[model samples]
Target: MAGEVVGHAAEAAAHGVDLIPVVALLGAAVIGVPLFKRIGLGSVLGYLAAGLLLGPSGIGLINDPESVLTTAELGVVMFLFIIGLEMEPSRLWALRKQIFGLGVLQVAVCGLLLTGMGVLLGFAPAVAFIFGMGFVLTSTAIVMQILGERGELSSESGQRIVSILLLEDLAIVPLLAVVAFLAPSSGDEVGLTARLIGIALPIGAVSLLIFLGQRIMNPFFAVLASSKLREVMTAAALLVVLGAALLFQAVGLSMAMGAFLAGVLLSTSTFRHQLEADVEPFRGILLGLFFLAVGMSLNLTTVAGSWQIIALSVVTYMAVKAAAIYAIARALKASHAEALERAVLMGQGGEFAFVLYTTAASAGIIDGPTNAVFTATVIVSMVLTPFLLIGMRRLMPKPEQSMDGIETVAELHERILVIGFGRFGQIATQTLLGQGHRLSIIDNDTDMIRAAAQFGFKVYYGDGTRLDILRAAGAANVDLVLICVNDKAAATTIAHLFRDEFPLVKVMARAFDRVHAIELIKAGVDYQLREMFESALMFGAQAIRELGATEDEVEQTIEGVRDRDAQRFKLQLMDDLSAVDAARSLLLKNAAEQAREGGVDIEEEAVEEEVAKSTQPVPPA
Candidate 1:
């Protein structure tokens, strides 16, 4: 009776709860990401580990990976969307040769070489052709993240890597068509007209998005903002992405490509920054889940059974691709170190390789066993990328690329260290740069960093709260560090962190409000300016002078206000708010009394006449 009851109860629970995949994925991410990060590996490896552990090869936790893949695919779509937002249309145009010219050369040269090898290994010409196209792709997500992390995304090698990746992304739909043509399929399903329609969908979508994006997004965001709820804003941002995705899928175009077009369209809008902030958290979580799903698809049993063949394939894949990329880089006149470093970064087979394999398998163009082998090779190549990058850094000699390389953060030597390249940080940076002071800007927002780079500011990618990031940005060596992020907690954390680590480097912080200012002051920040404090003070000065005070009196009043605020900040604001408040009250009273005694007074009627005259603009000399 007891055994029967337990079995029944288990069944009921299983039927009641249907979130095994979500729970399992979250569990893996929670367990894996931090551990990998702790051990010096990246979040990508963490996601991979989560997938491997939950996959059939490990515990068989995710028995139905296909369903997970359906969701995980959204990750790539979001990734592309963000990438589109990072580069403007005009900026993308500037790299036309890199995107079209060199891109075609690299793919044709690499694909043909790999195809030759595949044919030699006994694959049919058609099979060899598929392998050539698939293996020609490099891991865009991994390589681009690594490049951005190392602050090399705007460098020479970085530019080359991006151009190729951009071309590969654009090629996916067309390549799928080629694969369809090669496959022995019914004309009804994969006919010439159907292919043309598919091709037309993406082109038409791009044009439509370019035309309609700003008009819809700006007003849409304005309405969302008027609601004054962040959640509403986030939902609308997601609506733009998913709505675009659905539109593209309806027309038989790539969902990812459609979302990317949507993002690019929104990039030109005033709501770009707000939209990025809203979608960013979801994008990150989903992208990692995507990598996790890919990891889970790797069947360890298959890998072990054909270990020898798989190993050889992996080696050949990396070697052949690296050779091709290195040759191309050298032909482009890249220095030896830059060429070799880029080659290692580009050698890994792409995420799209596995995607194409699955697509082919579903279309019956490739058998299950063969697809399994291809999948293993692509995954292993991706897994080896981080280690390969690390090895390259260790082995390759540094290059004489720039005056300071700007390739790595450690080499970033500037007098002014500005943290957070958002709107606030940009104001500080633009001012400092305009004054001819050398500056090193750091921000985790790659989009902001990329945009700033277009205008000649090289911003490093790293979180300001991290000590290592600060050290890498040369905080200790710099004379002043500016904390200009909008997040109050983050601003406070950075201020305290710098005080502990680089106390000698004076910090000037931008506070969100009075409460935030108090927190920053407690963090040992030498100077804290509330974001609107000066503007408010200036407006108050104008109001005071118009209320009958002379210009000299107005100036003195503003000076006293600043002095009083500084005195309040100097107090122990956190532990003794009562004392600080008392001091503030006393200061205000004494200053008011002093002002009443010292300032010149005017009759009320005379003040109104004088104010009307002062409101007029000064005549030009």
Candidate 2:
């Protein structure tokens, strides 16, 4: 038994952080994350559960989990790096107010309140001071994961959350250093100066890095690409991260900050996509490992022994922190529900607290027993956070599940109306929308309307046959009313209505056949188009070319057929059903004669297709 204990201690020691713990951890994550995910508990909770199972409260797989926790800071760097890759400089500038203003207020208010709580709980003022600062942090990994899972990262509140987290990440260095600087015996002048200088260089290392990268990095990568060795580029990418990390660490900054700056520099680079593809796998695995380390580091034995103290501390800390965040968010004009979510989402002790606690313990700012309690409090808050998130889900407004592909017209500052969002209407709407036209699209399908809402399309559910629907869609203000109703009679009604009610609007209607086109002309639509007319013309032209007609011959034959059919279509519009039949007969005879004159023998079907392509409300002239 003595030998076993000694052997285990040796394995857990600084020189030999055993591989068994790593293997056990990976295995547990492999098994646990999916199980938790299946039950909708989320993957972060699964990692924590695995940790609890392997932690001191259960089987002691790793006696000293804090060591692994310390090593897992790399995962934080990777996480920040990936975040940086997603952000452009303009976006960062846009978030500056959130990062500096709201983030600063959150830290100040929460830290002060937490510090007061610690003091009331009988901690020394200095210890309470650092405690407040450290505990003000919430778990970035967990919060970001939750926000991402719910697709709230792009939401207004979620953007603020990200900005606040960035500020906290930046605050760690100064927060850690400040309390230490206050200690009477501390001789940290050089260290303090180095950190200060690091933060405020003339060009700022971040700017310098970006400037240098824009000039040299592009050409460097280009040269590397010429070698045609992908492995080399990947290696160079890793090296870039490493170099940035070293530079920042030398200046007393977070290594994650360095990685983020490096990522931002590469964000707009031509190789950004490839770099992300390469870095994503590493970021994902390392981030998972980081969370797993947090779980393992939970000293649940201490929590059980001091359950009363642990529970009191967590409750007090979360209450104070949440109250502060909620009040601040509300002041910032976040809605009641939004403020509540931000509060609950951020009501945990951050991963940085462990570093702070460990550092304070080493500096004798906080004793061992106090540090243990505080650490447990931090972990307990984190463990409960998944539950908090689950609860918040009940209040958060459900997002749309599909996209209907309709955009509102007035929003785009241009006016176009699309009636009948069927297959034909949808195609026309999509094309017009692509050209920067603002289109108000109305469809009869409620399911399509709801589904489109998910994709952020604002489509109205209404029948095109209703004048009320047309007025609501602002047909009067529209420059063009694209009528693509699949029904021939319904389409004719809409064309006439637009021509009568909104005469200034361009009325273009899709026709089912030549008969529909003539009816649309009689109804006074400005233009009439057969849906498949151009398609048939192209097909017939291709057939003519394949059948040994030269390009000029095919062009001339198609044009001749178009002219003759246009004349026939005019006759149909001028007369009645009998006149249309007579016009078709004359058109076929003329096309066959023309095809012979051009030495391109035209089939009856080919002549008919050309005639269909040739018909217009009025001849081209």
Candidate 3:
């Protein structure tokens, strides 16, 4: 009976272990994600917090986190992949001087400086070097995320930091390769030259494979994509990621780097957007899991033992890094406020630090106690980042004069209306303004509104889509409604709301594209301009020059296509069904016939087959 009881107990324990991860993940998403979002903090922090709470140190839901960590590692790889995809090769090359020159200098200077300090603190030279390498890489994930949230991603300072971070990411490969070669498991007598060669050989092989694969992969994907099988396309995407990762591992390089390169190659493909949409859901879920695993890996026991050292290290590292970044920004000619903001945002150690430190420790280059201290310090620094950004914002110098110039009550007309403010919107707004229209423009972006206000234009901050704000903006008496918001969703919502609430008012909207115009038309939008119409006309004029067509002939052809598109547009608007299908069929048929007439022997049937497989009914619009 005792034996029987022991077996049953063992089985129960096994089952409990299996259920822990599921419970931890579910609980974290349920409790943490919403809480973080509600507080206007990013979900990343919530994931990290959830991981820490349910990890071995907290609720002990995850005792052995290795599997989860591996999965999470894939998330990082995918993250980099997507980032690389967004950046074209030309753009990357344009920034090459900064990425390589400034980036290399920053890493070398920071690493050496930090290493020297580590050695002075009594660490061996090897250990100090390892630590320096780990410290040199700032968190690309955190910095990019923060920049994106604040809309500074396109700003000068943000771009510089992004370039630096990209270089650091690249630098990690070499650093890890060196650590791997120097690992105690390897023979002590192995020469540096041979070790370097060992690393180089694998990298070369991987590069060759990627080059060759691209030639084949693109066409293969093109064929599959032409088939229009969602399942097949999704499978192909997964294959690209998993295959590239596995290939990298086989070549002895990091999988993340391989995934990044693969994404770079795919960025050149015409179907990049479609692939992005298909892969986004998978990427998001996997990334969340990856972050959760990172949380689970936090060793509370180690942190507890070296809290003082960890605290001091974090403070010192952040201070030094921030100062270094600030100096770099000034040298790079950034404004003082911009430099300060950049410094604060990039002061923390990042996800790459965790990877580097762990790899170094595993290679026996760093002692266990030192690794624990540094790891904990990195985590602490990350925790402080959000607060640091908040403080930076508060410290920004306030302008002496308010930009709002609503000096007189008469200036605030009861029937306040806004016209276009974008390149598209500006023309319409200017035309109306020249006619002495009493309009108060509404724009969501604070910076844009400020700029316009500086030029003595009256503008207000509000999302035009929101009915409450519109009502507050005097929708009752507003004689005209201008729905010039760039975002399609916002434009649509505003039009619908305006029509329902104030049917008597005229509503003019800017369409995002041809499809957008059709949608607006269906929704009873008064006047709609295709966003690309003007640009297309300009292009047509340029094409006429190259094609040797007379001005009249060129204009006639342009008018023909426009009329056809407009008639199709109207038909689509009226029927409110299968516009995209009719458009694609018409366009593809024309192109196929042209190719065949040119003796190119184009596959019209194949093209149609692919289109039939690939094209989906555009949602509503």
Candidate 4:
């Protein structure tokens, strides 16, 4: 009877304990995320703060962190997988020189320099090597996220940092293998040759899997996609991830490496976009959880105790790494601004550092106290990255400019005016120019105009919607107004302004759909093109061919569907406009009725009403 009572108490305690952490996590996100956003910092910081607050060192709510750590590992794997999908083989090959050459140089130089410092500071050789490796791998996630947010991901500096990060990730693989071999459990005296062979096997297996698995998986996915079962496809995607992960584990390789290979394989597949759409939410949630786990794992008690040492280490690590990266970037012939940005961006220790340090500690490559110090340093470096980036931005030199013989708009005469210079407008401009038209395009995006100028294209940097700017572009005498802007409301506004201000000009506009085409037609557009209608027809035809339908039958069916939808769309467009007009008329009638009830004679005011209606420009014919 006493034993049964004890068991019941234990069960209740377990249930109560589980609820506390869940509530705390939720509460933190609810309160902290908004607060962080309000303060102009990102939500990632909020999540981290939430984790820290609820962790054992803070509020003491979350006790068992191991489960969260496992999930966080999965998050890292998924993150790498998505990154692999984004990096196509051809693109990877393009960066091969930088990745292998600059990347290898950075890692070797930084690792040796840091290791030498660590050894001099009284660390064991093995411990120093592990520390060096940890410091060598920069935070790909944080750096990339920051660069992407700043819209600098395509900058030369960003590209170099990315290549270096990729190389670091690759380098960590062999480093881990060496650590494993050096561990007591792995038979330390098995010789360097045997250890090297062990490392080569796993790497070779992963390469083979990527080369062969991609060909087989693509067609398999295509078949599954034809079924049109979303749930099944999602299940299939999860299966691929799990299966690849299992294979990696079976071969004693990193699960992330396997998932990455799987992603690369699927990158070339036709269904890549669909797979990304399906897996994106899962990846995001898991990544957030991973970051939270990282926060929870932070031993704030240790940090508080050794504040001075931790602070010095963090500053030293970031300073040394930044200097190294900047020097290497300059050596590679990067511009001064680019070199500075790359150095600052890649100055922090990464998620991989956490993994490497922890694994090395477990393998006895590093002592416990040293491991703790490095871990604290990694966290502090990560926290300081945003501030470092801001400082770099302030310090970097501005680009030089030459003010020599630049032509003003007043000096140019043979100008072909383009109203909108979007994708369609650009095509139209190029096509016309091939036939000897001296075109001068107009667009709102300053970046687009600047880029166009680099390519020797004459583009006017101003909004075409304003009549003054239109006049400035010589709209009265210029050849054409190609209304290629994507926004419907903006397009309509510009069309009205053009018709009212410059009625003699010819106007060709792009329509959103068949209904939009009809609206454009009524708006007195000289020509209208339905953007995606033809593309949709072509897709249907392609589907029919895959489904074993005859070409003629497929063509006829597509044509029939197109004609029917176009007609239906036209009717609907007319009906919608008529309904809107009727509603407006009813509103006016009701107001007039109310006015009459108040003894106002609206019928006698017919002349005033006619004048008001006349002054209001007629709706497009």
| Candidate that would win on TM-score | 4
Ranking by lDDT: 2, 1, 3, 4
lDDT of 1 by residue, 1-621 (tens): 967865676677687975655787898899889998888887788888889889887788677766786787777777777777776777778889998998999888998998888887778887777776788887777776677668888777787788888888777777777776676756655568876877787678766776668666788788778999988888888888888887877765667778887887777777888878877788778878878877887788899998987798789878998998899889989877878887888898887787678778877788999898888888888888888877777776754324232334665788888888887887767777788888887877666666777887777877888888888888879999999987888899999898798888888999998778777766778788888989899999989978999999999999999999877754535345455545655665555556557884535565445445544432210
- The number of residue pairs in model 4 that clash at the backbone is 0
**Per-model TM values vs. the true structure:** 0.64, 0.64, 0.65, 0.66
Locate the minimum summed-lDDT window of 10 residues in model 4: 403-412
User: Candidate 3, overall lDDT?
Assistant: 0.75
lDDT of 2 by residue, 198-278 (tens): 558623766666776668777888899899898898887777776777777766667777888788777788888877777
Best by lDDT: 2
lDDT of each: 0.78, 0.79, 0.75, 0.74
Give the Å shift of residue 158 in candidate 3.
3.2
Off by over 4 Å in 1: 1-15, 185-199, 398-621
Which stretches of model 2 miss by more than 4 angstroms? 1-19, 184-212, 395-621
Mark the regions of model 3 whose C-alpha exceeds 4 Å error after superposition. 1-17, 150-155, 180-188, 191-200, 397-621
lDDT of 3 by residue, 1-621 (tens): 967865676587687654546765987977897798678666667777888887888887577766787777777677777776777778788889989988897788778777776677677888777766687678766676567667877777677887888888878778887787667776457688987887687868676756855687778888998897999998888788778878877766777777777887888888777767767777777777866776777788988888876766677767877787788778878778777887788788777777788888787877778887887777777767877876777787763344354331122345646634666666677777788777867776666767777877766776677777777777767777777777898888888887788887777788898778876865667788887887888797778869898888888888888899878876665565565567777888888889888887867679879679645643333
